[model samples]
Target: MLLAALVATTALTACGLPRSGPNRNELLAGVEQTAGAPFAIPVDDNVARITAYEPPLTFPAAFRNAGVLGPDTINAGDTLGLTIYENVNEGLLAGQGQNFAVLDTVQVDGAGFIFVPYAGRIRAAGNTPEALRQIITAQLETQTPEPQVQVRRLAGDGATVAIMGDVGGQGVYPIERPTRTLAAMLARAGGISNEPETALVTVIRGNTEGTAWLNDLYTDPSLDIALRDGDRIVVKQDDRTYIALGATGGQSRIPFGKPVVSALDAIAQAGGLNTNLADPRGVFIMRNESPEIANALLGRNDLVGAQRIVYIIDLTQPNGMFFAREFLIRDGDTVYVTQAPYVQWQKTLSAITGPVGTAGSVNNALN
Candidate 1:
């Protein structure tokens, strides 16, 4: 009679029983009475799997082709060391006793022109050291017989890339032979200060900007693009993250530990699911998928912008674990696991039986 009464009491109050969160049935039975309801998708199809793999970080074609300047190439704001050698005793630039005249620290102006004693204003920004030497010698041929001009390239504010953020050294580095490419420049900047798997490198040049994963920069030679003068390079950790909640071991906003995070990896990172309470059939990944992917999945095109998507992966299925391993987790996604249906029943019985047993013990003590 007591057991029957307890079961009846539990049946009456089961709706009020406290639970961690809604079960899979409640999560799906939610009525979409109005617009903007979350779409529930099962991550069990090729379309869904393909949609999960978004494009990775890339360097634009223009950035890759911009090309770096030669090691000895001159640019505006570069300092030059010029020496004019003359054979005659009476020369244009040679000192009284010396046959060669040393003109140190010749500055290139912002307009890409440099002025010599008798060579007049000449364009030096685009010319290499050897090429500029010939131009200077030609200029002094009329004033001094067979003038020999030697030009030496000097480092200054010229043709430099500003590297900042998570690097061993954050400063402006000259784009010479040692630092002409993106990888070389990053190395010259003392490598990355953070984990390479989670680090990102961004290059801002004029009106265009490009970015790539630091790890990809090493594996993919094409991503190691040429550096441009005045380019801004910043190395920083990837800000992309996702949320893990419900029956998982931990529930928090977990930052992506690497460039790519698979669903299996995400589950592992969250310390795996609570095996005692988790429903193997109710692991879900929810996010607002792109309209293109959503349309492709739903076989419709009316939807625009980002559409709500809830992806389920059932570990109970034969190929479920393999599919989870293949499904990728994107930034800002939510990974949730529903508790088994019996869990609430267990809670309800415990709730009623605990109080009943305590009251029975008090009665026995009084007797």
Candidate 2:
């Protein structure tokens, strides 16, 4: 009788404790009666309410305001193709013909100056091809009558951006023009090595930096911000994932195939709950919320000490499926489904039946 009582007590204890996660029923019950405790929100009526909550990340505002598009400006180490024209009849650089023209290719020196025949060394860097043409013409007109100049950029590596990380091609990509965008540079680098949904782009503009999902940059027009010279773009594969445990087809950490993953999707990705053993009322998403979100949900700040939150969803109810479809599962969240109480009874019954069957078989063999 004592053994039977002990067995019954053990079974009851198992039923009281959640099979997947820690038994937080007391904490949940406390919050249900009062609001000052740690939050254990049921996903029934509050799914839509918490949808407005954002992750605590300060996305920098330097990504906006695409600078005005301008012609390709010269940079130091650039090769400039200069075509100079002069009137031979009265020009210092006069040739055999009445009209004199000279085509010369010059490299901008370390000091960002290019040497001309009579203009000496002119500052070629920071000026566009047309701007350099005007400067050369102004200097030549002083000595050579009717000197006309045209400048063209041959090649420049300093005006380019560096692309590294998880891209198919990692190298220096030229800015080409002033209006070159982040997406344009990504294209020039052969896109990313992974799917857009599973990749993110980080733009390192000097000390300031910004990150956006590759899918967002492609879909959201505003997120496809402009790229700057000397900027380093890295296409990193997102290793973000959620862990699925307990009575589910899969219990390992699962990577998100899409940018946003819902509770229903998470369950489906885990091969749905283990139908035979899963407890319909014990589906949960466990995660630590930021302090701001915890305070907002609990309605009081000082009372709740920690931001650890557990969201429960009962799959047996009709409304549960609807709520689960809308409840988003964030990165690093733990999705767990508890085993049903009846499954424990099945285990006890099998244990008892195995002994009884063995005794009956031995007695029959003796008879």
The lDDT leader among the candidates is 1
Alpha carbon lDDT of each predicted model: 0.86, 0.76
Candidate 2, number of clashes: 0
Q: What C-alpha lDDT, on a 0 to 100 scale, does residue 43 get in candidate 2? A: 85
**Range of the 10 consecutive residues with the lowest summed lDDT in candidate 1:** 29-38
Runs in model 1 deviating more than 4 A are 1-5, 31-36
lDDT of 1 by residue, 1-367 (tens): 9889877898877889876688888887752424667777677759446676677689899987666667778888899999889989868877787788999999998888999988899999999989999998888898888999889977656888999999999999888777789999999999999888889999999988888988888898889998887899989999989999888888999998887788899999998989878888988888888888888888898989988888888988998998898888988999988999888888888888799899999999999
lDDT of 2 by residue, 251-327 (tens): 89999887778899999999998889888788878887877667677677773444767788987788999888888
Alpha carbon lDDT at 244, candidate 2: 97
Candidate 2, clashing residue pairs? none
**What is the lDDT, from 0 to 100, of the residue 268 in candidate 2?**
97
Q: TM-scores for all candidates?
A: 0.94, 0.83
